[model samples]
Target chain A: MWHELARPEIWVPWLLGMAFGILVGSTPGLTATMAVAILLPVTFHLPAMAGLAVILGVSFTAIFAGDIPATLLRIPGTPASAAATLDAYELQRQGHGAPVLLTNLFCSAIGGLVGVGLLALLAPQLARWALRFSSFEYFWLGVFGLSLSAVLTPGQAWKGMAAAALGVLASTVGWDEVAAVERYTWGRTELFGGLGFIPAMIGLFGLAEVFRSASHRLARRPDARLEIRSASSRALRTVLAHPRLILQSSLLGTLIGALPGAGADVAAWVSYGLAKRLSRRAQQFGQGCWEGVVAPTSANNAAVAGAWIPALVFGIPGDAVTAIVVGAMLMYNIRPGPNLFHENIHQLHLLLAIAFLTQLFLIPAGMIGILGFRLFIRLPHSLVMSAVVVFCVVGAYAIEQKWFHVMVMFGFGLLGLWFDRHQVPVAPFILGMILQPILELNLRQGLIKSDGRFQAAWERPESLVLMILTLAMILGPAMWHVVRRIVAGIARPRTSESSP
Target chain B: MFSAHPARTDETAAPGSNRGARGGVSEPTWKALEWTVVGCAVALTAWLAGGGRSALVLSPGDPGPWLVPWSAAAILAVLAIGSGIAGLVGRRSVGAPREQETPARPAGRWIVVLLSAGYIVVAPVIGFGVATVVFVVSFLKTTSQRWRWWSAVVAAVALTLYVVVLFEKLLQVPLPRGSIGW
Candidate 1:
């Protein structure tokens, strides 16, 4: 790994790839997945190590760069960054854009390093543990993730649950995963596959913000500028104070990302929710809290590394980006899974080295992206809003080359505006949408496997543990309050009787 | 069917004093909307459960596709109704609008919504590029006091071209070409 790091050939392509990724990830419609796909052919021409380096560089850089738009505008450059948008946007509105961006950049690098370190040390062990997880366990895990939304949301939990339910309902618009039945298409050909996630996301965050800004009577303050030098040190100190949060979020992200289907997006949401639940400043989460920004920023980048675990260990693609990397590896005659480690030890070392170096390269690449986008943030509000609208339109339309997707984007934008006005948190809805299919699929499968007996889910040790955790997460707070009241009642009588 | 605004304690306050009730929908109206949504979800789930084209028995006693959706709908229905009733009763007991914290200006929101809708509706008839230019110009002119029509047009055109070139030409991701073509 050290020997490989010394080579100039590796460093040049890695930096170039990171630079390109920053551009793609900062754009509203162009996703990390799309960036990797576009760069796939280019990677094919390079050597195996160089190709792997490119993929690693792009994936990590893109994930970090996503926070740029998410901070400056309310629009998330990638789905994973959506969890950060609420806090990032609020912070940006408060003229803390530079500090927030710096925090995000710093956390991303640290989280990426942590994830790679864990991958190097624990891939096989964790993969073995993950193998014990059955559909029943997965069902409970999904429910647990969903339960965090209620805890994470401010004000009314009921509203958050309602929004989540609505998201689940929206997710069920296409063909059923289990029965192969067309569930809720409403007779449109495009509806056969369900609402496109990218289009819907783009509409909810990107176009909705445009609508919001356009509707505001007061023009944006023209003097607002990105002040990085003064803010970076303070931001770094703030982030450093939350070492426990950074570590926990990174580990959790890696675990979730190691799941074959659940990727950085899910990891980010779950981590953000968990951070809010555990934070002393939970109330400040959606109102521009630095902790809120750090949690998701760290988790998303960590998940990028975590996604590689399954791909390298079990020949399973952890997410869409890894799936492409797997394809690229196959083209290079480098097979994944256990045999590859024994046969091609050098390749494995190279991959681990590339992951580390890619994260290290993020320091410079992220600064560049932040400084470059900072200039754009100084544009007048009218021009910025108009450009955002155009980007939203183009982004939605580019999804499947169908006008209907754009229509879906428009509809969701309207829904987002309504949600915003009504004080219904949008994050829960997104979390529910992401988790719904996984939950439904697993639940139905568990039921079938159990022969309609609910007890069968509890028969497996992992499933039973997950079930207990889910129950505890749901009922613990209420039970704790009740117990506290009872104890207080007993103490009050004694204290009153003995009063001097 | 429920008023979102409780009877105003300050009669002297302006007509649009309540910022809490968005779009001027009263408290009861919002609650009724929640109830309506819950009812529709329950009905949809019940309909799906009853009407099945194909039934598969994974095991001798297994319920098929309807089970998950039905269970979810049941949970949602219960929660929604519970919340709705709680909110309604709570509002009735405290039957007064809170002091207005901010003045409502709904005109801008409606204007933008309408402009966006028009842009969506007109894009297929006129080309995407042309519709975007028109929408941008109209939106800037409406929202900004010092709006310049020519600059707005130039900016809109340039932005549209940037999108087309980046997405359509460079990335080869086909964008919407309306009936008017390029």
Candidate 2:
């Protein structure tokens, strides 16, 4: 594995791909999927190893570079980086920019290595486990993810849920996947397939950030200056201190990523939530806690590696990136699935090497991305904000080359602004939109299969577990409050009688 | 609608918190915004419930397509109304107003919104390259009055060239070239 990486043919395309990934990924709205797709034709004629190198490099490095904007600005470059906007940006606000990013870089590499290692060792078993999930389990899983986002968002739980509900409604705009009918298109051709996620995401995170910066510029609040400098110190000590956290988050990320439809974004959020709940300084989580940065950054990149497990074993794409990758693999006549292990074992080994080496390459690639972003932001704040607005426009337009998407971006930008003012966290809204299809389709399908008897869900053990977890996540706090009140009332009466 | 929660003013809200007086657009009329959202949610719920129930696809066992839409819209309406009512009652209970807190500036914000809207309207007509250059220069001058014209033009042209090379030349992803073309 080590010697294969030493070959110039192997390393050259890989490095070039990493550079491209950093450029595309750090820019809001130009997702990793688009980058890989755009590069697909170029890779068609290249050697198989070289083609794999470009795709794998972009996929891995993009997940890491996404943390750049999420930490430096409140905007996340990709959906996977959304978790970073919570704690990483807060830490950056608190002037811990250098150490926070450095730690993020280191942890991402380690977490990715751990994920690749696990993928190499346990592909078959994990693939089987993930494949066992049915429509019923999928519904419960989506609910659980939604419930987690609601609780994790910093606001009134009801408000978070409201935002999530609004998001789900927004997602219902296109075709009804099961029924083959439109719900909210209102006859616009652009609304047929639905609002694209990338445009809406940039509108919310990118354009919304620009709008805030404009407000701050007018308000004369000079609080939006770049904080990328002041140090270029090592974060090795901090990383060393959190060995257990790095391991745990990586493992958790891998497990979640192995689940079909549960992508890196969900893994990051789940890991961040778990870390906050277990930490001694839980109260300081959203208020500039470093563990918050580490957990999500580590998990997101790890999930990128874990996403390849099902892609390799079952030929089912674990996420969008892998779908494109598996498609590319087919073009190369190196098919995915169980037979590939027997016939193309060497090709599998090549993928393993690329995944492992990609982590090592993240250090240089991430630094360049960070420095480039710093230089960009170091421009005059108001100019930078204006430039970001233009970038958002271009990014939105680039998707399918449609002007309607630009309109969608602008509309969502306004909605994001409105939501921000109302203290509705946009994170849950985005998650809700992403998960709505899975939630709605599976829910109806499960109901249909069970003849509308909801009680039948309890028959499947996995479904029961997931349903229970989802219920607990949504209602646990309120029930806990009721239990505490009952216990207090009983104790108060006993004390009063004893005193008399 | 503009009543204040004197004890817990928007400025006093915790950072990353649900509370606080948000500056900017919502400051003047959050009640209307909240109620508007609630109204929209309510209308959506009614539409989904009424239509889906009457539709033939909703068989005895299957919930059909509108189940999620109705449920989600209903929940949103309920939650938004509750939140709006709480906000209203909190304002009314305060009685006397305290010293007013400064809202986040909306002057530049309005300019940004206008500029963005203008860009969207004009870009397809004028093409991405020309439109981008014009947008950047106008945005810079409007936002930063003291800035030099030459520098702004230089920056605008540079950004245009960069994007043209990126989207058009390198990535081969075309941008809007309008009727006359760039």
What does candidate 2's lDDT look like per residue over A179-204, in tens digits?
A: 66777777887898888666777687
All candidates' TM-scores? 0.69, 0.71
Candidate 1, residues A282-397, lDDT tens digits: the string is 99999989889989999999999997986787555566577567656877898766566667878888889889878888988898887666454455567666666676676667
What shift in Å separates residue A278 of candidate 2 from its native position after superposition?
11
For each candidate, the alpha-carbon lDDT, in order, equals: 0.73, 0.73
Residue B142 of model 2, lDDT score: 86
- Report how far off residue A369 is in candidate 2 (Å): 4.4
Give each candidate's fraction of reference contacts reproduced: 0.25, 0.40
Per-residue alpha-carbon lDDT of candidate 1 for residues B10-122, written as tens digits (9 for 90 to 100): 22335434434757656644654565475466547655644655755435535666665565566567666765565555543122223322323447667877888898888
Residue B32's C-alpha lDDT in candidate 1?
42
